[model samples]
Target: MTGDQGTGALAVLELLAQEAPAARIEALLHEARRAGAADAELAELARAVELARTVQASAYRGRDREAALAALVDTAHDLTSPYDLDSLLRVIARRARRLLTFDMAYVSLRRTDGTSYVRTSEGDTTALNAGRELGEGPSLGSLAEERRAPVWSADYLDDDSVPHRPGIDAVVRAEGLRAIIAVPLRSGDTTLGALYGADRKVRHFTPDEIGVLLSLADLAALAIQQAALLERTREEVTELERFGSVTNTTLTRVRHLWDCHTRLARMVLDGARLSTLARAAADALDGVLQVRDPGGRPLTAADELPDLDEEAVTRAALQAHTGRSPVPLPGDVWVAPVTAGAEDLGVLVLRASAALTDEDVRLLELAAQSVAALLLIQRGTAAAEGPVRDELLQDLLDRPHHADLHVRERTRRLGIDLDVPHVVVVARPEGGELGKAVAWSSSYAYRCGGLKAVRRGCIVLLLPGSDASAVARKVSAELSPLLGHPVSTGAAGPARGAAGVAGVYEEAGRCLDALTALDGAGGTASLRELGFLGLLLSTDHDVDAFIASTIGPVLEYDETRMTDLTRTLDAYYESGGSPTHAAEALHVHPNTVSRRLERIAELLGEAWQKPAQALEIQMALRLRKARAALRAHRTP
Candidate 1:
């Protein structure tokens, strides 16, 4: 070729780059003909022009692909912003139509059936939304799956080369759809679904257009996966927050429980009153709390609630005792057995005005425990206060003359006033456990501020009282059931000083012996109840007082019956216990004397003829006569 042909070829390339019309190409070919060119030269120049045009068009297409690639990058960024599968799909569909010059767009996620249906649609009005059901019929999605590549159709109704589904064909015919392309939406080896672009007019799809749609589908699939992960993360965060809230509430409740129990423990340690402790616990439990003795007597109360329902409290207490814990009543009340092992100290009762929970019951039980500890301490002190009290009482009773400053200080320390008017009581259990009897006696003595000593099968007590007989009766009444038998008790008192105590103890022993011989010591008695014999044993020895007590019944009977009962009784004892001889002295028959003696026995008691009663009667008769003579002489 010549320089002219080379230069013309270069001009054709420039014109093609500028995208000159076909008229300019023909005019250039004519100018080559006018250049006196040979047919071969002209034809060669024409061929060069065509080759340059092809090269220029190829270069321009490459630049267009570059722009498409840059737009796909921006689309990928926009797809990430959607943050949800549905929204990301919509963005993908919209960007696909705008980037690829389609009139409508839509998206379909692949179902498990391996078929495609329109999830989102744009750019086409069509009933051909169902691409294919692979098992049922051949579809675009199935075809893509089979080929592992994109599928496209120009004039889909007329095209027989591509796979067609009848349902898809019917819808395409109704909507007049022609050109169609579907790209597989893929992430790694998994094919999610297909993205489709279609037009109503038959048109061929360029490779660049198909590439653009495939890139968008890839970005959308990644965005959809990311959205699913983000949704899962949000759910996990919500669950964690809810769990943390529950844990925080549990921790707070535990802290409150610890504080309440700690306060209760401190109250017990500080020796607070039962009422004070109950009040604190009631505040914590939001209820009316009470501490009761084993007998249901209220020891302390936290509120002015209704009067105690003793029956209900007792039933609940029994239930609690059986369980060895707290129990609920018919009402909103609960009770806890206040006990130390098998020994039931008392009960803690609570009447709740608000809802009562297991935690509140736990607080009630703790209060009961505190109350049990206090009661046990008290019982420990009263039942047996070590050996101090027993030893001091035994020393005083055995050797009273040895009383010294130490005894005085010990008595004072033990809350005893030895110098005060006091009584001496001696008791023996009739038939029972001796250990239990002694325990009962010791506890009773301590409660009354007295000292007790057990010596030689006898419980001896020196208590602060002037009435010996009353003290003896109290001991018997209080100890009979506890010791499981009758208590034979005797007392003597109104004594003072160690010497007086010792003397009264002897007198009290004699009284006990006298009662034992007469009544077998099945009951209580004292010198004051015994009569002239008691006067003989007593230090005071008031003869007139003894006479009045010993034969007062006979004297009063004689006065009421208008008979010589006292004189006949004196005559009878004067005749050496012979009713016949006494009748001779009294100017009456033996039968008459016997009748009067029988009446005397009726007035006194059936045992009036026993040795002790007989001796007392004789002494009263002699003392009465002596007192009568003395009064007669003094009056004259």
Candidate 2:
């Protein structure tokens, strides 16, 4: 072609790229003819236009194919959830109609006799459209099924090459469908059903459009198989339920077991405690409940179970770790192993008048499984966080002054506020059951929004509180039972911020030492609780502060009223707390000394003469005298 003709064709191609109107293209053709373009050049330009149109149509077809693939993928994802067959088939039919622009669409399932009946129909106006049955013959739906491929006809009524079945042909005539397609819904080599789409115009189905129809059929087959399995399962469950309700004895047993299962499942869902499960099992089995860890120590239970044969319980519980069911023990106790898959968590021990029946044992086992699931969840959560908590707590207690902003952020994520008042509690359980003590204390600390760590041989916790002694006693009381031995706790704090924890921990350690030295092991105490020993053993010896605190009121009363109450108090203590003897020591009348003692009681508390208070008072008096005598000896 000439350069001018090539240029004209190039202009037409550019217009096509811009998607110019038909009128604009026609005007351009007239100008080309008026410009004395040769008939051959014009014909070449026509061929270019036809080729451009074909390429443009092909691109549009490719875009449609991409959209169809995406839609089918999304539909497959949506089918991941459960669905009934009728609902799923309707969905498939509706999708087929929309994607292929079919005037009508329907799904048909093949019967055992090789006949197919419409299961679902969409966008159809006929009443017989859905229930329309296609007889067993070499027809549209069966042809696709036998060949395991898609079958289509441009005009079903006029297409003589395609063998048509009377029943299917009758429905097509009534629906006025001219073009129709069918694809087999296959599961492996077995065809379960067929999906059909039809239009009222004589139009040929494209290969890509046929593929889209096949995709919908695949989705329909998956839905059918899933729904079949679902229906079979429901039938089995219904049969069992029906059989159970037939007789009173069997019915009661089944109902009781089912109730137990439901309650336990609900407990796991709602995050109920192990103790709650123990109580539920005990009630269901009519036995006393005693839940024990693998090592034979008793855990918390809903009901207080009596002391049983500990050796038998431990032996049977351990045997249950590998056994399939609850292991029978002496003294009418059954131990059901609690496990998370292959990992043994613990055991549920039941004590009753006699060992439970097989069904009741199963009930107890169900409870054990529930307990296992809950423990596994707890263990998994702790496995991630417990180490971090322990490390942070150890660091905070050991090097509290070094806790910087990063440490603060870590603490914040853990829901711990470092700026608040906190205490350090130390516990040392007897029998060296460190593991049991640590476990119990860790749970206690978490609930209090505090941190726990094992330092030395003791379980230490940094807790939120001001009452150190109270915290100590609570820990000792609660942990002793879990450890199956006595636990002594010592605490010191109400310390604010990370910088104060170290000093408080040291003080708490000394308090523990003082308690043990006083033969108060297995008891709880704080520095102040130790009284004189606390004062002497204190790292920061505030003797003057102690003296002022102990006898400040009496000293102040003496200075303000110019009274000899101090000397009276001194003589009273020197005379063995006897006022008549103190009178002679003070060289005053007994009445006057008695009156001064009463005044002293008013300045101090009413419990001034009490043993604990009297000891503190006498200690302060002696310390004051020692300081004065030392000062006098140093004077020049």
Candidate 3:
């Protein structure tokens, strides 16, 4: 190669620079030939041009590196801001559009099944991609996810390498999309989705642009994961708060129940009566409380309770005791069993003005336990005192001579007087429930001031009263139901002192016998109400002696000889001593009546016809008639 030839090549190169493309290359060749350069010199001119082109390419690479580095730094700093998934995605898309200078930019996430769902978009054509789904078959986004790398298309509409989806095609046409660059959003080895930058006119994407998008995709994936963790932590905190609220409410209820139980237990320990405890329970529960014995008699004053249906309460209480459950009664009432171990002491009835909750029922059951204990104690005390009371009563009624001073002193201590008008009631319980009768009598004695005892197959009560018959009737009515059967009570009194009591008791026993003989079950009879029958019913009356002394000879003549002498005498006195009228009343002849009267005078020692003797004879005859009438009436 000669210096002249090199000079000529240099000149052609400069000409090439001045002109352009194929025509300019031809002009350069003409200049080169005119310079008479050798073939070797022409080759040297080509090599120098190639070297200049290489230098220009290096400068362009340097500029691209600077831009890529700046984009990476901006993305790194942007990620440090506290942004939620939605905000982070929008920022990433906007930054991508700015860095790559594309017509549109967007971010999409891959669903669980690996389908890309576009989340955010930026720029003029963003509307087309908003909320769009990119399928896995072969779009640029799908390719990026499938290959786990960046994908690009210089002209997407003409690119047949990717599968054509109608929706994607429509949007691409509407937005005039010509080129696109997609990079997968990845965390570790997993691909989250894709980040897209698109151009409306044909454009080739460079490696630097793909790299910058890949960095932004990484940041978006991290933001999505952080948001998920934060959401889960918030849900856990809410659940814990709910559990705490429930626990606090339960603790409050338990504490209230404990306080109620403690108060009830303290009442029991203080030796409070069952009625007192029931009142306390009512106050605590804000309801009515009734403590009943096993027989359904209220241990507490029934007046203090509401007007409850006792029958309904009884049935409900039975069901509750049998089933071991709280039975609901009408009018917001509840019935529960009061028990001590296996023994049922009674029933506890609660009638609330308001609706009761389950906790209220529990508190009532606790109170019931305390009441049961009190009732048991009362029964124990009653059992211990019954026998001594029975002994004192028997001695006073049976032998007043031996018991006069002792009885007087006992009555004094008991706050009653034997000298007062008292009735002796002798009750023969026809039901044969002796145990129940005894218990009832004992309880009656304790409640009202009286002495009651079961003796000689009968219950005896000595009560202060004005009328014996009235007292007897009262005792019968009261004890009958308790014993679950009828009682025949006989009373004799307004009797004073122990001797009077003994005599009245004898009369009362005789009355009891007469009542039974008449089959008058559950009937109450006294010496005063027995009428003429009282003469026969009582041993103290002397009607038979009087009749014998007054009309003895008449009785003898009538009994020994079948005669109308006694009948004739009664007829004569009833007719005012008229023989004719007597005969007429006797249904006989007047002369026969005269003869019968004369026979009557002979038998009576000659004063029988006088006014005084006649009055005595008439009285005796009247007594005989009454006795006959009584006998006839009682025969059946």
Number of the top-ranking candidate, with TM-score as the measure: 2
Candidate 2: minimum summed lDDT over ten consecutive residues — where?
Answer: 376-385
Q: Rank the candidates by lDDT, best first.
A: 2, 1, 3
RMSD to native, candidate 1: 46.8
- Return the lDDT, model 3, position 539: 65
Give the per-residue lDDT digits (tens) of candidate 1, residues 457-492: 888888888889998887777677555678888789
Give lDDT for model 1: 0.73
**On a 0 to 100 scale, what is the lDDT of residue 455 in model 2?**
78
lDDT of each: 0.73, 0.76, 0.73
**Candidate 2 — which residues are off by over 4 angstroms?**
1-380, 516-520, 542-571, 583-613, 621-636
Pairs of residues at least 3 apart in sequence or in different chains that clash in candidate 2: none
Output the worst ten-in-a-row residue range by lDDT, candidate 1: 377-386
Per-model clash counts, in order, read 10, 0, 0
Best by lDDT: 2
Please write out the lDDT profile of model 2 over residues 305-380, one tens digit for every residue.
6777777777777778867579887677788887644555578878876667766876787778667655543442
Number of the candidate with higher lDDT, 1 or 3: 1
Q: What is the lDDT of residue 157 in candidate 2?
A: 89
